[model samples]
Target: MVTKWVLLPVPAQDADSIELDIAERQRKRGEPTSPSAGELSDDELASEMLRRTTFGAFIPWPESALERLAAATTETTRRWSIVMTLCAESPGTLFSTTDISERTELTIGEWRTACRHITPHLRKHYKDAPLWGPGLYEGSTEWPLVTMSGRQLKLRHELHVGITEEQAKRWRAVLNRTTQNVA
Candidate 1:
C-alpha cells in the first residue's frame, strides 16, 4: 500500500481568537465563560469558590446544617471527634476503621460506640431513611453519615458534601467549646 503525502497550508490562530473559540464552546455548553465577581458579595465569592473546588461532584451544606450537627453531637466526645476527623477529609473520600482510629487515636470500640450514639441523630435528620441502603454497604445500621464496605468506610453522600477544611475547623471549634464547658 502506497501512502500519498499532501502538503497544505495550516491556518494560524492568534491568542485572542483561540480564547474566543474556547469561550464560545463554553457558552454553548451552558457554562459561564468568566467569573462575575463584581456582582457577588465576599461571602458569596467564598461560597462560589468552594462550590467550584468540588467540581460538581458534591454540593456543600449550608452553615445551618453544620451548626445543627455540631450542636447535636456536642455531648459525645468520640462521636464529635469522628465527625471532625471525617469532615477534615476531602469530599467523596473513602477510608477505613483503621484510618479513623489512626486519625483520632481512639480505639475501634470507641468508634463503634460513637456510631451508635450518632445514628439516632442521623436517622432523624434523614427523615428515618435507611442509610447505606441495599448494595452499598451491609456492615451495620448504627453508622449514619458513613458507610462501610468490608473494612473500608466512607461518608454518605449527604454528609460527604459537607466536608472541607474550613468546615472541619468549625467542627473542631465546636468540640473545643464543649470540652471547655465540661471542664
Candidate 2:
C-alpha cells in the first residue's frame, strides 16, 4: 500500500490577520446604499422635494442605465428602458413607437401601453407630454423629452450642438416653467 500527497505554497499571513481581513471585507459589503429615485411616489413628491431636487440631470444616463433597463420588471419601466435605450443612441434625437418596437423587439401595442405609463413622469413643454402627437412617424410616439419647438428635443440638461446657448437657455426657462406648473 502507498499514500501520496502534494503540498502547495501558501501566503505567509497569520491566521488572525487573514480572519480580520475577511471580516473587514464582509463588513464593507454590508454598507448601506442611498435610496433609489425609483422609490419616490407622486404623492410623496412634495415631502421629498428636497431630496428629489438634489437628484440632478442624468442626460445620456451612464451605461448603468442599460443595466437598469435590462433588469426592469414592470411593464411601464420596461418601456421606459426601451425608449431611453434608443434615445441614448442619439441623445436629443427623434424616434417613434415603431422605432422603439423594432429596436426592443416588443409589439407595437405593448410598446404603446408602456409609453402611456411613462407619459406622466416625462416633461410636457407643449400642451401635452413630450411625446403624443405626430411623432417621428404617424400614429407613433412623439418626442419624449422637454422640447421648445418641433425639432428641438430637450434631453435632461443637454442640447444638440447646433443649438445656440440662447436657445438652450430659453429651453431651460421653458422647461422650468413647465415643471413648476406640474408641481
Candidate 3:
C-alpha cells in the first residue's frame, strides 16, 4: 500500500495546533462530504477551509536541511523566512551587505559570514532550495541558482535531497504555494 504525506513546516510549537486543524478539517469542516462532515471519519471530507481560524508556523526549511542550516549558526532558522521569501520573489538580484539586512529583514551583518558556506550546500539538499533553504546566488554559471556575480540571493535546483516520494510531493506543494503567493 502507498501512503501519502504532506510536508508542511509545522514547527514543534505549532504541531499540536496543526493536528487540531487537520482533525477539524476532517470533522467539523468537511461538510461538502456530508451533513456533519458525517458518517465518514472527519477525515473523509471533500471540502475544507483554506484559511483555518488558526495560525500556522512559518517554516522556511524542512527537517533534513533545516538541521544543517540551523547548525550553521543559531540564527539561519530564525531568519530564513524573510531571506528565502525575498530570494524566491527575485532570484539572482544582488543585495549588497547593506541591502540584505534592510530588504530581507535580516539583522544587520547577519548574513555576512556564514552565508557563503551555508547557502551553497543547500543545493546538495534541494534543487529549488530557496523554499526550504537559504536562497544564495554566487554567480557560478555551472550551477543552478547561479548568477553573473557571486553576490546576493537566488534559489533554483531540482530535488535530490534523499526524501521520501511523499516528502517530494510536499516539497512540490510548498514550491507551488510559494510561487503562487509571490506572484
Estimate the TM-score of every prediction: 0.38, 0.30, 0.29
> For residues 1-183, what per-residue lDDT tens digits would candidate 2 score against the true structure?
121111222377675676566557655767323224555444344423322221222122222332333445567666655555445445433445555566777777886676556544333212332223443533332333322321222222222121223323433444455458779
Alpha-carbon lDDT of model 3: 0.38
Candidate that would win on TM-score: 1
Give the per-residue lDDT digits (tens) of candidate 1, residues 1-183. 222222222356575776687679767877766445554455444534444444232223344454555555454543654555564655434345556666666676676666556656555563333334344443323232333343121222212213444545555666577678879
> Which ten residues in a row are the worst by lDDT in model 3?
46-55
Off by over 4 Å in 2: 1-71, 119-183
Per model, state how many residue pairs clash.
0, 0, 6
Candidate 3, 1-183: lDDT as tens digits: 222233344589998888777667656644332233234332222111111111121223354443343233445434543454444454323334455566765665565443544455545544533342233423321122222222111212211111223333444456566568779
Model 1 pairs whose backbones collide: none
Candidate 2 local accuracy as lDDT? 0.41
